[model samples]
Target: MQPGADDPWSAPVATGPVRATVTVPGSKSGTNRALVLAAAADGVSRLRGALRSRDTVLMAAALRELGATVTEESGPGADQGDAEIVVTGPVGAARGTATIDCGNAGTVARFTPALATLARGDVRFDGDPRMRDRPLTPLLRALRELGAHIDGDRMPFTVRGTGAVPGGAVTVDASDSSQLVSGLLLAAARFERGATVTHAGHRLPSGPYLDMTVADLRAAGVVVDVDDPTADLLRAGATPAASTRRWRVEPGGPRPLDRVIEPDLNSAAAFVAAAAVTGGEVTITGWPAATEQPGRMLPDLLVAMGCRAELVPDGLRVTGGGRITGIDVDLSDFGEAAPVLTGLAVLADSPSRLRGIAHLRLQETDRLAALAGELGRLGARVTVTDDGLAITPVPLHGARLDPHADHRLAMTYAVVGLAVPGVTVDDIATTGKTVPDFARMWATMLAG
Candidate 1:
C-alpha cells in the first residue's frame, strides 16, 4: 500500500515470533551527502544503490536546480543493484537563478543553501510549513559571516551568490543540529580561502554524523582536519567534557566518486526492533562490516535490552529473548534512531531513561514532547525530560497515534502497534519521507 493510503492504519499485532530476512533500501544520509559532495566535485560522480526516497529525490532535484546534471540510470522503482544516480558536478558553472523547494528534508534544507552560495546569481530556498520552524539560523548566520550575501535568517530566504564564496573560519553554535556543521564543511572546498568551522556550544548533538561527513569528504579526495575532545569520552560511556570541536577543510573541491552506498541502518533498526518486541529473529542483508553511519550503534543498543545481535556471514541478525529489559542510555550520537528506540522502551519490563538528545525538539517535530503525548495516548507512562524521555513500562492499550508529520515517529508508532492490538497510526505516509513502500515491506516481514 502507498503511504497514507491507510490513513489511520490499524497496526498489525504480532500473533507469533516474526521471522524474516529483509533487505532495506540504501542510506538516506549517505545518498544526500553523496549528492551534495558530487555536485561540488571536479568530475562526474556515480552513486550506486542510492536511496530513492522523498528526501534523496528532493536533494537530487535541488542540485539539478543549481545546474548539476543528475540522471537516474534506471526507473524510480528499479532494483537496488541496478539503480544508479549519475551526477555531473556543476562546480564552476552553477546556475545563478533557481528556486529550490526543500520539502521538509533537513539535509536538503540545511545542506543545499551552502552549495547555492557558489552560484553567480540568486538562489531562493523554501520548504514545507514545518521547515519554517526548524533551526537554520546558525547555518544561515555562518554563511553570512563567511562573506556570502544572504537575505534572511531562515527558510524562505535567498542566498545571493557571486559565483564564488569567500570562505574562512566561522564559529557556530550547533547545539541544536549537527547539519549546521556538515553543511558548511561540505561546501568548504570550493570557498576562496577554504573553511574552518569551530563549534561553540554544548556537546555537539549527533557527533558521529560529523564523522560521516568527514569520511565522505576524504573519500572524495578532500583534505579535512578534525579535533573533537569529546569523541573518546562519549565512546567510553562517560559524560562529554566541555570543550570546542574544530574542523578545517582545505580549498580544493572534491574529485568524482563511484561509490556503492550502504543500506540504511537507521531504517533497518525499525525491523530489528520488530524482532526484539516480538521475540522473533530478523536478519537485515547488506549490513556493512565497517562504517561511520550512526546506526552502527543499533546492535549494541539492542544487546543491552535483552536481545541477541550478531553479525554472521549472511548479515546482521537480531533475535529477541521474549522479554525486553529497560535500558538507561544516552543517544546523542544517533538521535535519528530515538523514535524507534523509544518504541522499544514503552514495551520494556522496567523503566528506560534516554538522555543526551535534547536537540530533538528542533527536528521535523518536537520529538520528545510528541513521543510522550502519543505513547501516553495508549496508556504508556512516558515523561519528558529536559534532554530526553523517561519511559516506564505499563500495560499499553490501542489508540490512534499522531506522528506529527515526522517520519521516524510514524515508524515508532508502528513498532508499538506490533505488541498492542488496535493501535492505529495516522499519516503512515510520512514514513515515505525515508522508507518508501513501508506498508508493503512491513506486511511482507510479518508474512514470513
Candidate 2:
C-alpha cells in the first residue's frame, strides 16, 4: 500500500560505521524503457530482473491499458519485491478511448503519450496534479509535427490516433527535460518515415541519459544518427560535417527484452550515502563495471565529497572517513545523483555548490524549491540557484521535512536524519515510487 502524506518516519541517526552489502532491485529506467520497447516490438518479450515499484508499475499498467499484455512473475534475485514481467507487443486498439495514469513518473508522462500515437483511437492522459505541470509541450509539438492529432498541450490531454504517424524531421527545444527527446525516439521506429529529432536550444542536459536511450534503441536494431553539441564536443576535428543537436531513428520495429536488466544504481546510491554518513563501508553486489546509468557517477561524486571509493571484485565499495568535505561540481549529465550530494553537503565542513540541475524544477516536484525549504527547516543556509543550490555547512538540528510528494526529497531526508537527531520526514510512503521496501532496506543497511 502507498504511504499517506502525513505518516512521518523517525530517521535513525547512525552512530557507527554502516557496514553492509546490499543488493538493490532492478533499474526503474531499464524496466520502463523495456516495457515501452517491448510494446513496440513484434513478439513476446520477457523482462527479467525488473523493478515493480510505483513508477515502473505505472509504466507497465499504462502499457497494459493500451492493449499490451503484461504478466508478472516472481523475480529471480535476492530481493523479493522484484519481478520478471512478460510483455506482448503492440496489441492493437482499433477503437475506444483509453485513459492512462502517469502518476508522477517523468518517463510515463512523456513516453507513453507518444506511444499512444500508434493506436487507432483516442488516448487520454492525466496523473497526479503535479504530473499535469511537468513540461509536455515539446513532445506534443514534435508529435503534432509528425502527424499526430493531439488535443490539449499538457496533462488531461488526448492523442487522437489514426493508427499510424508520418514521422519526419521535427525540432524541439528540449532543454527542460531529456525525457521529451527520449520518449519520442523510443517510439519513432513505428512511424512511417521514422524520425529526425533536432534540439533547437542549448546543449542537452543529462547527456548520459540520452546516450542510454540511443544505446537501447540501437541495441534493439534501430538505426540512429548521433549529432549533438555534446557529441560534437566529444568528437572534435574529425566529423565537421556531422549535424549537431539532432538524432534520426530509422523506421522499424525494436527487439524483445532478451537479457536481464541491471540493478537500479540510482536507488542503490542512498545505501552508498548511508556509508558516507556513518564512515562505514558499503559494497553493493552485482555492480556493473561500466554503464550509462546516471548512478554510475556516484563514485566520483563520493570521492569529491571526501569518501574513499574502490572497485572490488564483488561490487563497488565505498568507505567514508571521519570528515566529509564540501564540493563544487556540475551535475548536468547526472542530475539524479544531486540529492545524495545535497544530503552530504548539509553535513560537510565547508560550502558546496551543485549546478546544472535547472531541469530538476520540472521533475516529480520543484526539487530546488523543495530542497531549499526543507533544508532551511533543518537549519542549513541554502541558496536556491537558477540551476542548482549553494549550501553552506552549518550545525543542523532535528526538524520536520516536507517531501512535497517527491521520492528523492523523502529519501534525502532519511540521509540527513542519519546524522541529525529528531528528524521526522513526512510523506515517507512517497519513497515507494522507486525503492521497494525503503524503510526495511534502510533498516537492514543500518543494522550492519
**CA-lDDT, candidates in order:** 0.89, 0.86
TM-score of 1: 0.96
lDDT of 1 at 237: 80
lDDT of 1 by residue, 64-132 (tens): 888888998773445332258999986444554688999999999999888988876788999999999
* All candidates: TM-score: 0.96, 0.96
- Candidate 1 regions with alpha-carbon error over 4 angstroms: 3-6, 75-82, 91-96, 230-241
Q: Model 1: which ten-residue window has the lowest total lDDT?
A: 74-83
Write down the lDDT that model 1 would get. Answer: 0.89
RMSD of 2: 2.4
Residue by residue across 1-448, what tens digits does model 2's lDDT show? 4346777788888988899998888888888988899998888998888888888888988887778888988876635358989999884683378888898888999888778888778888899998888889889988999999999988889988677899999999888888899999999999999999988776567878888899889888889997767566666756333324889999988877576788888888888898888899999988999997988889989998889988899999999977789999999988888887899999999999999999898888888988988899989888999889999998899998888888888889899899999999888888888886788788888998
